[model samples]
Target: MLVQMFDLLATRRDFFVGLLLEHVQISLVSIAIAIVVGGIAGILISEFQRAAKPTLAVVNFLYTIPSISMLGFLIPFSGVGDATAVIALTIYALLPMVRATHTGITNVDPSILEAARGMGGTRMQTLLRVRLPLALPVIMSGIRNMVVMTIALAGIASFIGAGGLGVAIYRGITTNNAAMTMAGSLLIAVLALVVDFVLGFVEKRMGMRSKAAKRTNRRLAVGALVACGVAAACAVVPGMVAGAPATINVATKPMTEQYIMGNMLKDLIEQDTNLKVKVTQGVGSGTSNIEPAMESGDFDLYPEYTGTGWAMVLKKGGTYSEDEFGQLKAGYRKKGLGWVGMYGFGNTYGIAVRSDVAKRYGIKTYSDLAKVTDRLKLGAEADFFERADGYDALCKAYGMRFGSTMQLDIGLKYDALEQGSVDALIIFTTDGKLSHANATVLKDDKGFFPSYECGNVVRTKVLEQHPELRAVLKKLDGTITESDMARMNYQVEEKGEDPEDVAREYLRAKGLLK
Candidate 1:
């Protein structure tokens, strides 16, 4: 496993190393914010002893909220991206930071404080020269804990379009590439360990009671900050300034197929025009997150589906229809959005049953499956259960009454079905696993599912600004059929091919690229 991980590092040095820098930047930013805010609050609470318990209680309550829940709560206010991730991480760091500072400052020897007072030391002088120094070790311990936890948690920053090592981990898991997954996990683990070790050394150095040791401590702090700043700069987004080149920010839903498409979009736009493209892949919850970011101009465009636009974004009621595409277009226009490059494919929802189960039950359609649903266990990704067209809708439409329903990760549902842990699972028609799975796709006989033809959902203002993008974006229109998309997905997910390479090869085969 270690050798495999190293091999992956060798092959994909840029990807892992880039994410490492992003992780560092986010962790450091969160740490810096926590120390400033939390440390100050800690000092105040320590001085006003009456407020100490109450402030700590409030922060402790905040610390108990799950990170995912906190992020979700913050999304509406902060929008998405690095801002939200940093805020959540800083909030989580507060309890430890404040408690440690307060504990350290208040625990200073009374006699020493009295001696400082007797020597005519001012409050500021006592704190700076006497109390803080004594409290440094305890404070450093808290900082060390906060830094390590912040780094580990930063992996989740990718969920809200805040890119970090977590993106690599998510991609590897989705694509069923164990080596890639291990490589990402190992990098994050190594990073946390390295940062912890450095901070630990600094903590010990700060504890030494001598002029040389104090100078060394200052040097270590500056050195650590400089090194981290350099690492972070390496992964920061291409700088945008008053005179910078025109740039397009593209977003993608969290899926292997979208990653391939995102890279393709970047390559095409950059190749055909002067616009620089930045693709942030795997924005969690698809339309729910990305749409808002789009509205706020955090993203200029992304691949979107007709059904998602119809139901999720426009909040249109009733089953979706091809006729409603016009309405969807008009609705998007109201929101200053436009659709282009409708890729020729339908990734509609489907229910797949283990071949053995299908054969035993003679299930070929929703109606047929409904007859025996009560005897079978159903499974689907958590998002599937929440979407309007998902589990409950299907169950009501066909009167399905499963014996049990399991909420599994999108990547694990197929595995669960294959292993006989689940008799049926939901899937997108374009899922790569479907190409070689031992499952039968049951017909949506009731016409319950909606079409999900993928397309570029661009900000209309961008179109007006960069006319060249229109042609480049349209190059993908009607170019890829369902089979083409599924095969591309298969190449990436099953074969573990790089998504950009797969997308590039497909585009070349179609003579859409030089």
Candidate 2:
């Protein structure tokens, strides 16, 4: 395992390096902005005691909101990526920064201020020269806390398609690669500790009694601030900076197969064209997030399902025309999008019963499973329960009456069944777990679930901008089969193989990648 991890590091050195730098850039910028804005607000509140309660209340409330939830809320307005991430991180950093600055300033010696006034120092001079310096230690403590917290919390930024080590973490989690997840988490923790140590050193230096040491500390602090300014500038725009390669943003759902697909698109685009591809894999709500991002021009394209668009995106009814897929394409075109490269796979939904349960109950099909559901429990992800073609509808259609339904995370459903927490669970056709499941997938004899043909949904503008992409993407059409996807997913999820490697191998096998 360690050998594999080392190989992963050696092979993906540049990838990890880029993500680490991005993580640093985001954390630095968020801390810097939070300190400035939060410090100002803190001073204002300290000056006007009446505002303190409400101001702190608001900051505290924002701090309490989950970072993922905050990013989701900000997406419609700020869109996705680092901009949204920085904003959310800054908001969270505000509470510690504001409270610390306020407490430090308010706790300063009253006699000292009176002395400054006696010396004819103006109010501003007294606050800056006397109060601020005296409050430095406490404020530095706050800054340290704020900085570390922001750095740690910054990982969630990847959920909204922002770049960072969070990509590694999210990718690892999705593919069940503990080594990759640990590597990403270890780096984040180390970054936080290192930043905290630097701030602590600066704080200690400021407290030095010697004038020479004070001068040295001032120089060091100024140099650090200058470096921070440069990093912040880079973080503010990331790939949008002048001279950077033209970027195409592709998004992916939070699943193993989608992660692999996102990487495949990135590899293909970069290899075959002058453009750089930035894949934002693991967007929280899949189509819900990526569709809006695509329409708003935030995302250039993403892998999507035909049936999902049929029912959810277009809100079409159960009944459809013979050219239903044609209608699906037309619907997306109306929204300024185009479908390309049907990957020749149908990762549709399925029912998998614990092997023991299936054998004991003679459940070879959906109807057979339904007969015994009265004594068994059903399990599926939360979204599976709420989707248009989801739990309630599936149960109603098949006349299933499970003793109870357990809402599990998509990743945990297999484990839930293995642990006897559920007798049957919803499973994706391409799910890696299916390869090794101690469960039997029941045949959908009723043909209740809609077909979910997989393909790329690209923005019309992006296609026009890079006409060559149309041909490059054609290489993927009619390539991957459902079994092929399931096998690749298993490679990543159970074998701990890197998704990029697995994707590359598949594309290489098909002569699409070299």
Tell me the number of clashing residue pairs for each predicted model: 0, 0
TM-score of each: 0.95, 0.93
TM-score of 2: 0.93
Model 1 lDDT tens row, 1-514: 6787788899899988788877878888899999999999998998899999999999999999999899999999999899999999999999999999999999999999999999999998999999888998899999999998999999888889998898888777877777887887888888999989988876677668799988887887798789767755654544744666798999998888899999999989988988899888788777889999999989998998898788788977678877788899999999999999888887888899999999998989989999999999999877778877778888998898999999876767788988899999888899999969999998888799987888999999999999889999899889888888899999988887989899899888888779
lDDT of the candidates, in the order given = 0.88, 0.87
Model 2: pairs clashing at backbone N, Cα or C within 3 Å: none
User: In terms of TM-score, how similar is model 1 to the real structure?
Assistant: 0.95
Task: Put down candidate 2 lDDT per residue, 394-461, tens digits, no spaces.
Answer: 88988988899998756667878999999998999999889788999889998888889899999999
Best by lDDT: 1
RMSD of each: 1.9, 2.5
